[model samples]
Target: MELLRTKNLTKVYQQGKHTVNALTDCNIRIEQGEFVAIMGPSGSGKSTLLHLLGALDKPTDGNVWFDGKDMYSLPAEELARIRRQEIGQVFQDFQLIPIMSAYENIITPVLLDKQKPEKEYVEALAERLQIKDRLHHFPAELSGGQKQRVAIARALLMQPKLILADEPTGNLDKESAEEVLNLFIQAVKEAGSTLIMITHDAAIAERAGRVLRIDNGRVTG
Candidate 1:
């Protein structure tokens, strides 16, 4: 079944007198439980497309249908709720709160939703990501690879229906990057979550079931 679809999606930004076409009339469909990778060079609007798909940002034109509803047509609160509960995002920057411990960071989503985190599940995720031992440490105390793992654990902690990851392995060394990517694939598969990952590495993109290429704000299979 189709989990997400975009129709004539476009985003534009105004920088002074210049207009930037971040994304342009991109139409794509993603099915449930599929692993998809998007590849593009710098300034290709890859992140812009991901942000639109994940509901992190609204497009300037067209529609995004997630599940069965037109996402942008919904009220802000409902959209926010969907974003919080059904969508999980792993940013390239590893956006963990410095003040929160690794474990605390992982469970932040649940806590934000006023729900209890399942201890067993969180522990299992941490173990799978090889970050169980670093749970008590603060983000400041962890290495770059460890921090990325913590971020992955946090994103998966919610068991969201859709996972949107942007260059998830961008900050790690080759060995660490491979380890994280493999662990990520296994975890996503085990959870039966639909994954849309952005990567610059062709080898990494090949790991996904399907590969989409974007250039100058346009997407092609």
Candidate 2:
């Protein structure tokens, strides 16, 4: 089943006097339980595409469908709710709350929605990702890999239909990066979550089931 579909997606920003198109009529579709990597160079539209698909932005001209529902058609509040409840985001900066413990950060989404985290599932996931012992620690106290693991844990907490990650391992060492990427791939597979990741690393992109090459606001190859 198609988890997400975008038709003629376009994003534009005014850079002083010139209007730059970050993404230009780019059509894409991601299937359920599929791991996809959107790869491009620094100026390409990979990040823009990810943001569009994740419901974080309004496209200049296009529509995003999430599980057969038009995401853009919903009210702002409803869209935000869907992003939190049905879509998980793993950001490049880790985005963990500085004051909260790792456990608190991971389950923050549940709290925001007035729902409880599934304790058993979370515990098992943390153990598998090798971050069980670091739960009480804050992001400031964790190693790079450990911090990313905590971020991943938070993304997995919702059992989301789609996981949208933007350079998830960009800040970690090679070994740590591999570990995080592997964990992401495994979690998406095991949890039946669809994944759409943006990366500039070819090695990391190769791990995805499908790799799309984007450049100059379009798929070049």
By TM-score, the best candidate is: 1
What is the per-residue lDDT of model 2 for residues 1-221, given as tens digits with 9 covering 90 to 100?
88888899999988899999999888888889899988888988888888889888889998999999899999899899998899999999999999999999999999998897887877898987889999999999999989999998899888899999999999898998998888878877888899888888989888888998898999755
Candidates in order have lDDT scores of 0.92, 0.89
Candidate 2 off by > 4 Å: none
> Candidate 1 lDDT, tens digit per residue, 122-221?
8999999888989999999998889988998888888899999999998889998998899889998988899999999999988899998999999966
List the candidates' TM-scores in order. 0.97, 0.96
Error of 1 at 158 (Å): 1.1
**Decoy 1 TM-score against native:** 0.97
Candidate 1 at 203: error in angstroms? 0.4
